[model samples]
Target: MGFIDQLKTEYRVGGIVQRLIFWNIGLFIIPMILFSILKLGSVDIGIFDWTNPFSDDFFSLSSNPVDLLWKPWSVLGYAFLHSGFMHVLFNMLTLYFAGRLFLTFFTQKQLFGLYVLSAIFAGLVYILGYNLLPLLVGQTAKMTGASAAIMAILVATAVYAPYYEVRLMLIGTVKLWHIALVFIVLDLIYAPLDNSGGHIAHLAGDLFGFIYIKLLQSGSDLTKGVSGTIDFFANLFKSRKSAPFKKVHRNTTPPVRNSAVKPKDVTQKQIDEILDKISQSGYDSLTKEEKDFLFKVSK
Candidate 1:
């Protein structure tokens, strides 16, 4: 196969992470091409530029009203902008693996929520660290990368499937928790020394991911709020559906049956039986009869 064909086959946009990587690379390429054609070589369309958080150019509510409106989007945009080939490669690889791991156990809605929240926290940490730290010594530096968000997904996956194992190129299978520990340690130790802002952002994202998973175990999902926000805008643009509040009344009475059908009550014993089956044989192992019974009872 030719080089272009090989590239297309390997990296064709399909899953969420793959599509995101494609979009990022496309954005970077399109701008460069446009600039080249228009002879505007000096223009920089890169979303995240290294600017002092305290500087007038930084997105801050106190600094400028216009910038404040734009600040929230920067959190998302920064994830797609990379300074070099290696930067994007590393970030995309991390994203692909972490994202795949996350999707193995989470719904797309949950993954989307995790990504957005992680990116937001990462940006917040970057801003706070750059602005408040004396270690910066008033040096104006801007941070941008998807590493923080990728780290968040990685942490969340570890929390969700701690026993899941993956084989490395040289090493055999390794538990997910071991990988999580290594990242946590690296972030904690190196965060204060090199790329402090990025490290801080990563930690912040990781915290959110971990907390989100823990909350989910209790039958509460943080992603529900994010999904609601998406639904609000989607409903606004699309045609409105009839509200559930409307009442419908039937005028005619139905004929009575000779024998009355009794509603089947699910007993505690039956529930225990199902639970035991699930524990021993797994959810997918349940027979059709068992599944139907469980489904009806669940309702």
Candidate 2:
């Protein structure tokens, strides 16, 4: 397949990690492509420079309360943006693997909820930390990149499956919590250094992830609202995609079938086993029969 076609195929069939990576990479690439075209023409767009995503007034947080109030979408927009290549690279890499790990223990909807909501939550915390903390009040702290969101996935996976072992090259086996704790401690230790605002935001994301899992374990799922909001928008767009059927006055009752009814032999035990398989491997690892069973159960 051609490059673009391959990308389309992957996006259509790939997991959430692939889609998230596509968005981040796509956003980063667009600005660079624009810059290249402008550079070839030896032209400067000045105020019309859409290439500079960070320079946009909307690409801000509580560092400037007035600006943030005016551009509220910045909270979410900032996560998809990056000020540098290394920045986007690290965040996307972390997200790609962390998402896979997160999905092993939680639903895809839950992962999506954490990724988006954690970024917003982290941004808010960054703002609060900037505004409330006397030491950070005078400093300029403009946040961007997907670090906070990646951190959330990292922490969520660690918390959900603390003892889950991964056999690393040479290192043999290591627990998920061990890796997660190292990152958390490093952030905490480096909070007083330069880029403290970012470290603070990362810490906030870690906190949110742990709390989210804890609440989930306690029967208080924090992701339900986010999941519902996502479904609402998804269905809204899906509704627009389908051609409407003309209403007929003489229409009879809709056909019914045994499809709505489940076989008595397909017990909850079977479902639990399928779910366990998903947790150990992934949804993509499910057989065709398993996939069909899941689809029917979902319906």
How far in Å is the alpha carbon of 91 misplaced in model 2? 1.1
Candidate 1 residue 12 Cα shift, in angstroms, is 10
Q: Where does candidate 2 clash, by residue pair?
A: none
lDDT over C-alpha atoms for residue 74 of model 1? 66
Worst 10 residues of 2 by lDDT: 47-56
In the order shown, what is each candidate's alpha-carbon RMSD?
12.4, 8.3
lDDT of each: 0.69, 0.81
Tens digits of per-residue lDDT, candidate 1, 1-299, equal 47775455334324456666776677556655665654555656454332221112333222122344657566566765665567768888888888888878876667777887788777776766766778754555555567777888899999989999989878899999899889889989998789777778888888888888898998989888888998888878654664747788885988676454443333546655875666444455578987787666555
Off by over 4 Å in 1: 1-13, 40-70, 240-299
* Deviating ranges (above 4 Å) for candidate 2: 48-52, 241-244, 247-286, 289-299
lDDT of 2 by residue, 67-149 (tens): 77688898888888887888889888888879888878777778878888899999888888888888798777688888988
User: Ten consecutive residues with minimal summed lDDT in candidate 1?
Assistant: 52-61
Top-lDDT candidate index = 2
